[model samples]
Target chain A: MEDTNSTIYALKTSAGQERNVARLLARKARTIDGIGISSILVPESLKGYILVESSTKIDLRNPDLKVQHLRGVVEGSVGITFDEVKRFLKPEPIISSIQKGSIVELISGPFKGERAKVVRIDESREEVVLELIEAAVPIPVTVKADQIRIIQKEAD
Target chain B: MKACTVCKMISSKDHCPSCGNPTSDNWSGLLIITDPEESRVAKELNIEIPGEYCLRVR
Candidate 1:
């Protein structure tokens, strides 16, 4: 289990500035203890926002000094913590808490909130094999378990 | 069933060979390793052989 104190955050930057801002944040975060910077995600749908993981709450009040410096290199940054990042980088469990063929809600992705059947479970990758609720195709969709919340458990 | 004296890698060959430790059947927890390249656990556990692995030993 991850420590509750360990925070995750996002640095919202201009479209093209993700790489530059990430490099700067990585350097800055290392200076502080109880702080860490993990992976960065730039979704195609999201125009801005570079997701980052930090061990502590980030002070974004001094935008000009605290974030603006990196913003200058990038554009702008909105400091967000780990919990906020979970809405983006949902880490799913390696094992299903429910039975197979059960319907689980999609927590994140294009099919958010949509319930799908568990077709398979990739234990190694921690991904869930899902069959879309209203799809004409029978292909099983593999989605990260973290990105979903189990709504109802199917009977064995 | 033997335990490696160095890294504790399990082998069934014989004569305390392959990892230089006497074989022991006292292993538990089956760790299924399919892909070692992308698996952080496999890399961290230093398992090159693709098969079941013993997670804990007494």
Candidate 2:
């Protein structure tokens, strides 16, 4: 189980500068004590915001963290939970999570050792429509869900 | 089971099949990278490949 901290806060920063701010905070955290920074993240879909995990309430006004670069934190949005962040985390591949454009290597079947990309999925049938990536001509082939191993996901 | 010391990829073989590095059973973190392009965690870790990775391997 993950530790729970009530001091997690979200800070607004310059758009496209979350990475820089995170780096700065990490450096600053080494110098400070009592309030140590744990996790830091900048969601890809969101701009101008970064989540910070700390042991205690951070004095945003403190100059050590260089809060000048930070605009303001999201009030009432503190106490960020790991469960919340876990949702944004990359989900491991499962049978149902497989989708179109996912690259897979056949684990068992006539095309064993062959690599293919998912073109479609049949939920009721628990089968997938695959296109052989190495084939001279793109041809769609149907296979059972358990026949292939996921290489790259469609989301990637 | 063993973990690759190089890429932190978990594999049963003696060598890491991902990077061909030697494998060690001592490892932690079952990280899965589905999409590297839009994943901030992926960018932070400098991982470009979509596969299973570990946070730490020793």
Tell me, by lDDT, which candidate is best. Answer: 2
List ranges where model 1 is wrong by over 4 Å.
A1-94, B1-58
In the predicted model 1, the residue pairs found to clash are A8-A81, A8-A82, A9-A80, A36-A55, A91-A146, A92-A145, A92-A146, B1-B24, B2-B23, B2-B24
lDDT, candidate 1, A14-77, per-residue tens:
6665545655554454454433333334433345555543344455653322543244322246
Candidate 1 at residue B32, lDDT? 37
lDDT per residue for candidate 2 within A7-111, as digits (tens), equals 557788988777567657755665566545655555554578877666666677776666446777788734665666664444332458787899999998789
Fraction of the true interface contacts (Cα pairs closer than 8 Å across chains) found in each model = 0.00, 0.00
DockQ scores of all models, one per candidate = 0.03, 0.06
lDDT of 1 by residue, B1-58 (tens): 6554344455675434545555556443333333344333444456665443344332
After superposition, which runs of candidate 2 have C-alpha atoms over 4 Å from their true positions? A2-6, A91-156, B1-58
Leading candidate by TM-score: 2
TM-score (chain A only) of candidate 1:
0.39
